[model samples]
Target: MKNFLNKVLQQHSLIYKLILYVLTVVLIVFLFPKGGKFKYDYFKGKPWLYENYYAPFNFAIQKSQETIDAEILEIEKNSTLYFKFDEALVQDVRSNFDERIRQENYTSEIVEEILPIGQKIISSIYDFGFIDSQSESKLTSETLEITLRKGNLAFNIPPDKFITSTELLQFISSSLANSAPVELRSSMLNILSEVIRANIHFDEEFTEKAKEERIKNLSYTTGFVAESELVILKGDIVEGKKLEALNSIRRELESQVWSESNYNWVVFGYSVLVALALLMLLLFLRKYRNDIYENSTKTTLIFLNIALMVFLVTVVVKIDVKYVYAVPLCILPIILKAFFDARLGLFAHVLTVLLLGFIVPNSFEFIFLQIIAGIVTILTVSELYRRVNLFISIGQITMIYMIAYIAFTIIQEGNIEELNWFYFRLFAFNGVLAFLVPFLIFLYEKVFGLVSDVSLLELSNTNSTLLRMLAEKAPGTFQHSMQVANLAEAAANEIGANAMLVRTGALYHDIGKMNNPMYFTENQSTNVNPHSDLSNVDSAGIIINHVIEGIELAKKNRLPDRIIDFIRTHHGTSLVYYFYMQEKNENPEQVAIEKFRYPGPNPFSKETAILMMCDAAEAASKSLKEPTAQAIDNLIEKIISKQMEDGQFMNADITFKDIVVVKKVLKKKVKNIYHVRIDYPE
Candidate 1:
């Protein structure tokens, strides 16, 4: 167990990466929501093209959401709120008023005389809410409920009505005799009004409780579905009540109870389906594209792309199944292909689509349309650098989606008129969103340190700041780079390597010469050689210093690591022959070959290896005084063959066959540069 844990923790190991891959895929699948899906996808106002749905079990038919919402709204609007009669409020009001009327600052005869009469009028009224009214109060104690603050004082009183404000005021006036002075009577009435306020308050808790009760008692279902009854018939338009019934059947089907025995099988099926799809992706990378499989960054990007697509579909389906078509499924393949190859992108997209099939409604149709769109995406994105290619490819993918959906609809309904136009707009919207893929690729490049052809194309531009400086400062070296770029690009194409990568690498390989342009022979335009004054060893140091300078410049410019690889390995540890021979003659025993050689980890890829050959062959061809076809051919063959003999191409994974192709392409390209013509013309 300790050994296994160590293996898992060793992130540098391939075994650890594989374990991470499995765990990540498992976790993503497990996070998916377990929602129900109907066998057939039916749209409102569309015909039911599939078989009829029957009551699968004795499940209760439920009301529609709209109906339930409307019922709840009505219950809230009509349900009366109960305000318990608080006897304490009335007592508090009476005590505050009695204390006020006794404070006799006016000391009037009428005020003192009518104070008791006012107190009697206020006390006679039990409900203090309507004491100032002129009309007579009319409330029975039966309907109205009264509540007190004392322990266990909650109770429902008999039916009773509340006292009107007019009635309470009239009672207060009548209790004050008419002949007992009008001024005193008016003052007594004002005192009665001061004590008047509502003892009754609305009870939210009781009102909400009673409202729920009313809603529950309301009839949820207007009708029932008999066992084996056809809820929706084939060829019938599914709208209005028919659509509602079909949805009810779906809800009922999902609500079915699962036994313990098959419950494990449900989980097992999901595990096998998700794992098998992901395993196919893993095995494909291991077998066909081990370079990508070996790198966890690229591997994670591919898997994460698939997981995100699945997650979007799963979440969208859960929210509303109709909007699932709006998901940019093609974007997955486009994104993966931008970072990797077409095969990987297509495989990952197909796997994701199949997994989503388990959850998306009408799974067959969804898979078919998406798989076709993914294929279209892969084909159109063969060259993704250009903006036009992106636009055209998205157009083609959208067209495929629209056409495939139409064909599927016709097949299912036996006519073209049943095709859903909304799905076409969804596909069009998906295409519009696909334009954002280039921007996404930019983000992935920054985050993952990946360099695609689009980036290479931009880097290869001669007008770029670095390359322009290389051109302005070291014109001869820049010209050499241009020639070498052509040769390397041709060789890469012939040998089935990344031609764009090699071309981009060739354009920047000699950028180090810009620092000491005149020290290099190509940039030295005159007979004067700076090396003539320096010692042989010192001159070799300067020659070797260019590679170091180029690496530093590339790093300073923040060029991608892949492009910098060209500057590092272009010479492939080859010694400066002229200086080395001079040093050997001066001091044979003291000569250090390492100082004369370019500091190199050597060419580590087929493209870098080809660049090495092209760089050497192009530079050497420029020195030939008597240029001929045989001479150029021999020069190209000799340089590459010697490098192969020195084992400089060992780590490049290139075969001798690929080397022969590179040599042939180089000879032809060099011949064209010198404009070699047939001798028969003379």
Candidate 2:
């Protein structure tokens, strides 16, 4: 498992490393508990019940039971029947009926009355429910009488006034004494007994009605677990405590797991990935190493730049800072100038600015500002002739930054009043940071061995290290390269190509000419021509060996691949026509022109094609005498047209139109090089 993990880490890219860091942070924040407790309190008051049941009865005496019944019937004729009786008794048969009445009222008022009483009962039960188990009398009881009475007034008074204890008992006894039905008498007695035990009182009719209503609503107030029951006094405080304890335990468990988890592994993994990416970048740089240029310093600069990017990105996530996407943009140019050439820096800057949109996520406005500002920064510093002026670059960056901000605001349809300060601050911050660019370069160079685009320009000068070596060791080849540099640079500028590439390519194009210097025409002072003594095949072989020798020399010197590619592909597969023709004349129909061809993969790019055309045109134009504009134009046109026919431009991206422009520009430049002055006749 460890080996697999290490292998994966070794293969991971910078983007993958960044993604891992972000995921780790998310896991830490969300999956881990914050180690805080949660508490909640609930207060539930008891529901109340109102109304009560009561019995009403009257005494009656008669001569006979039949007479008494007839009198009750006459009384009932005037009033509604409101009693129950049993008819089986045969003694005196004097019967009187007693009726129990139940009161009906709104449930809310009933609840109000019952709640306080319920609360009292609950409190008593809680206080006494758990008496000593060892005791014989573990339960307690109490008895009190309740009275029921009808008011003299038509309307019912409040319950406290309408009923009295003496009245209820007296009414029950009197109803029993009369010729009352046994069933009615029994029911009244039972009700009186319960009322007495409860120690409460109510009007007869109202109490009976309330008892009936309570029975109907029994489901609302009964059958709850005794412990879980809530009354106004007890509230829900006990339940809340249990819930809070459960929550605290859950939180504690989460905190314990999070604190004990191996978080450092995540950090170590990400650090290792970053280290590996830096190592790869270093290896890539080393392949292009040059002794004359401080390659060590250049590699250091690149490393520091990558470190700064990682730092900035990490800080953004850690602090949760918002809307500073342009920070990466401000750092990119410095990085590009350090590791690669300045022209390549410009390209990288453009790509980096475009990528800022994805990095910032939904920040299109900032992305636009970065792109415009970056392009301006690169273009302002593009001219190799100008010294790097931080103030001027800042000024250009500031202008572009402001323009981008304003344009973004306008495009978004934002209000100027609301957004003006934001735009100003953004632009100001970026401008100030832009000024710090030069300082950053210095820091990069000091710490990381950075080489600036300005330094590269100085290195491209004629008196530079490689050029000096060439001049001292191979003067004729040096002169030849200088002439080629002039022509190629002019053609590059005229055709809107990379003039630096042309100039740099030209400078090293004939470093191969240095090997067997006298074997080539440029190094021969006298026309003794060593090749004159050799056979045509042997001479061609020696000439072809120079290209191979040049490649070997370039590698030993550790020249960049871009320069070496130019050296290898400049002649392409074009025939060494001069030598081929010489061999053909001697051998008649037997000589193979293919044998005399320069070993090449052909000019596979526009830069190499430019070098090839310029080298051939410059060398050929030297043979002209009394050169005129027309003559130079015709000569350049014929040379490039011959190369095109030979398929030298086949693999290159250069177009027919580009070739036409190259021809016209090369003609003008060659005419200037070979132009004649007025003759003074003797």
Candidate 3:
């Protein structure tokens, strides 16, 4: 059950799982129905339903009609009527007067002869008519008398009466004023007053004169005017129903817009999940931050840069696959190379390839290609050997990338022609990036400290600042270091260990000798040893002090921790056999082996174990008179066997088989250094 749970957890990302939980909560909250009903009545209709359905079109029409009726009533109260006639009326009057006179000779009497009489008679009749109806028949010999009736009949006049069209128009306007609404009546009254003031009138005389001639030729006619009453049009019931329906639809749409639904919950849940996943990723990166780079600031910056590059590539992938095909797996190796160790670069490559498998569609082929390219690039540049050219490493990486691409193409059954182009492009890109890495590293080193991976190579260089300092300060120690390095490197390679680390650690193993160089055997140029005058105990103390002193010197010099460990454990509680033998000969019973032994806690680590074995072997090999393969082999085996029997290799993880291999490799290396002599006739 425990394994099953762990396996299940491992199958999905922890980050993704955390996100999923948050998403689940969001989904539940959003999907939970607050009320039982799916629709709400409040928002069921169109927004403009009230405006369209209840607008008073009937009221507008009724108001307009009321305004028209009021105007007509006002006109009826104030309006008046008038009548007038012209020359045609005079001809009709003359004919009627001739018939009334019953004399044929009266027809020929010229109207010009009676014109002044007629004018006087008409003026007297108008004066009497305004005073009283009984006094209106005041006519001279040639003029006809006319009666004017008030209220009912407008005017009773002889046919010979003459009037202008303007006067007739004024009389008709007055009549209209009395019959229209007050407002209309007032306006008509004003028009009639103005016409009367201008001497314009319309009466029965004008009507009779107009009737005697052709209708088209009439000079004046009675004007009739009426205001049409306004009526309100009824509202459209169908329109009102349609508005309600629209409102219902709108309300339904609105409810849909704002309502909580499963789909909304799903979206909300997904969003929360995505956010949580991002947060988890950040936390995970933070926990392993130190593994990313030597320096925190540079590591963070490099990580951010890589993340940004990946994000950009992911966006591009979402847009189209043609541009950034690999989904940013290549960025991991580049970042590792720039900021961390080559081993880390390889790890990052694998991790990025796996991540790409999840992010990019159809990513397996690209992932395979990335892994191949990443391993080759990292391994090729892992070492900083001066003899290995930078361009050559880049060329190797490029070749690997091309080969991987070709292999992928072949596996996919791609055409050779297409694969060739793809291969060329892949090589070009990989080669450029790989070639540029060294220069970038060089620049980084100049600005920052040495990267841990290359620090071993730098320490191994003879011309290194620290090594040169060691050489100049303590030549005896430097020479001892050279011998020890040869042995340690050979032994390490045989035992499948880091030879560079072992060799570099050996080089600085005896740095403490610089404090008191003359007291050491290697630096004692004259045979008068500094320890000759001292007691055995005092001599042993001085020798023992070197180990402690070496640690302090290493610390002061800021040597790597591995070198310090090597210095601390190289002696591994082994007795100073030569000095012990000397003291034992003088006082066999009294002399203690512990008194001559180097202070140690035994070789507790592989590096220190190798260093201890190498230091002992190198020191013992110097006693051989004529070095030979058999003699070197015998020397190596004896040294290892003694150390083993003495329990010097107790704390070291080295097995007996490993020790044998170490001895053989040491023998080969030592024999080569001091090969058998060929006698010459010197």
Candidate 4:
């Protein structure tokens, strides 16, 4: 057994790697426990499929947060101010009045006249008591009262209601006659004002604690039912208190302690379902889009994005199930489409939405809307980096979501008025978030080294530093590259290949000619033939060196491998024919065909093969004497046929029909280039 285990461990084959990856992903999926699934997800006023439910336990009815908050607010409105009355305040005021009279040296007769007014003011206020100005609640104030708590005893007194602070002062002054002595008036007002102190204050801390207890004590469960009873018949619209009661029981059942047998079986079943979904994704990629599957970075990015979408749904659902629509799920397709092809984008989106259905409420509706939105995104989005395409595609996606959601709503509830307007806002917000695709594409390019259409578009510009330098140093080669780019792009567009990629590749294909510009005939403006002084072998050697030099130049300049591939495979294994034949005539027996060949990994993709055809056809076309449409057509046929004989396009995954289209397109384009122009009369 030990030896067998060692043997198995030592053999780390592709199958073993695949199993390891699947297991790792499954383990991650297992990490997020799928909570108990209730049969129906009910919002208020929605029809339910399940029969009437009954409470399984004697549980308190829980109140909704909105309901409890409203009641708590009302309790606060009705609450009266609390205070601690000072029994000694009255006695203290009397003593101060008597002492002031003695200190001022007032006559007994003057004191008798003023003392009544001062005492009357103090007595009237003291009888009423100084209450807190919770004076804003006038309607309640009329009937309002405060409790002056002294230990265990409480006294209820009418609240002091004053519209303004001046109300108290006005009452004091109005009690005196208008003709009264000024000294007596001033002395009486001053003396009375000093004795009045506010004995009542709002006890905020105590009131808050009381309100909280009352809110907490509110019933969470409104009603009860017995088990094995029909809570509602099938097809009943579960709403209002009925909906609330059913949800409470559902929560109870979800939270109920799982038995050893039940827990194991449910977990196992859930794991299998998750694993099956993952397996289907893998199999689809491996079968149809093997390029994505073979590249671990692409596969990892796909899985990670799906996992991220699922994780977002899980977290949002956990916080509040209603807000699940706001999680920006549209970002999944845009990001995937940016990095990969549209088919792969739609595939991953559908799979992710399906996986999240287990957790999301209304699984069928959620799946339908998302899948439709994803389809719209894939169909409408042509170039993700194009600002207009991204905006229009996102708009279409949002519209699809809105239309589909409304349709689903009408089908479910049979009313347009039942549609939730907030969901429309959420879908709109989701569409706006689709702008993240370009930024995410940038990050994916940086992290995974994946190229996107946006970067390809930027790279296609001829005014870029390297392309500009190539034009200046080797104008002939730059013009040739431009011709080849036009031909390749046309052919690519005709054959449903990536036209932008091939065009960008063609623009930089011959940059190595810049290193020794004068040696090539096109760049040599003088009649001097530099190759005439060298042996044919040496000349062929120089020509062959351009491929290696171009590769080095591309790498130094940090071009993508896709572009470098055109530089590498444009000549493929084709020879520098003129020099090779000249050398072979001198030493026919000793000449090796390999010596004249460009160091090549022949074209391995449709784009590279198209560039190869375009590059060779354009360069060879320059040699035609008496250029005509028929001559150009014959030349194109001869050159491309020769390349085919040499097995140049064996690995490019292009069909014979596609090659026919490319040949037709290239011939038409080349013919137009050399078409005769009649001279005009002077």
Which candidate would rank higher by TM-score, 1 or 4? 4
* Candidate 2 Cα lDDT to native: 0.55
**Which candidate, 1 or 4, has the higher lDDT?**
1
lDDT of 1 by residue, 1-682 (tens): 9997787677565775667677766766575554444567776667888876666645456777768888889777656545555677777877877777777454676456766666666566763343222212222333254332222455544323445554667767787765346756676677777766655555558767877889889887767777777777788998666777777777765545445767667666777778888888889999988878888888878877877787788778778878899999898988887777788888888888888887676778899899998998888775678788888888888899888988877776668876778788888888887888888888889989999888999999999999999999999999999999999999999987988999999999989889899999999889999989999989998888888899999999999988999999998878898899999999999998888887788898889999999999999998999889999998887888888888899878788899988888888888889995568853
In candidate 2, clashing pairs total 24
- Quantify all predictions' global Cα lDDT against the true fold: 0.79, 0.55, 0.56, 0.77
Question: Where is model 1 more than 4 Å wrong at Cα?
Answer: 1-23, 36-56, 59-269, 493-496, 533-541, 573-599, 653-661, 676-682
Assess every candidate by TM-score. 0.65, 0.51, 0.50, 0.80
Q: For model 4, name the residue pairs that clash.
A: 52-231, 52-232, 53-231, 60-221, 61-220, 61-221, 61-222, 62-220, 62-221, 63-220
Shift of residue 527 alpha carbon in model 1, Å: 2.5
Off by over 4 Å in 3: 1-348, 375-382, 386-390, 406-414, 417-423, 439-453, 493-496, 580-607, 624-631, 645-658, 676-682
Off by over 4 Å in 2: 1-311, 320-362, 375-381, 388-393, 403-456, 592-594
Q: How would you order the candidates by lDDT, starting with the best? A: 1, 4, 3, 2
In the order shown, the candidates' Cα RMSDs to the true structure are 11.3, 30.5, 31.3, 4.9
lDDT of 2 by residue, 321-362 (tens): 343643546557644744455554554454433433323423
Give the per-residue lDDT digits (tens) of candidate 4, residues 402-475.
89988877875667987879888988777777777788789989988878889999998989989999999999
Weakest lDDT window of 10 consecutive positions for candidate 3: 55-64
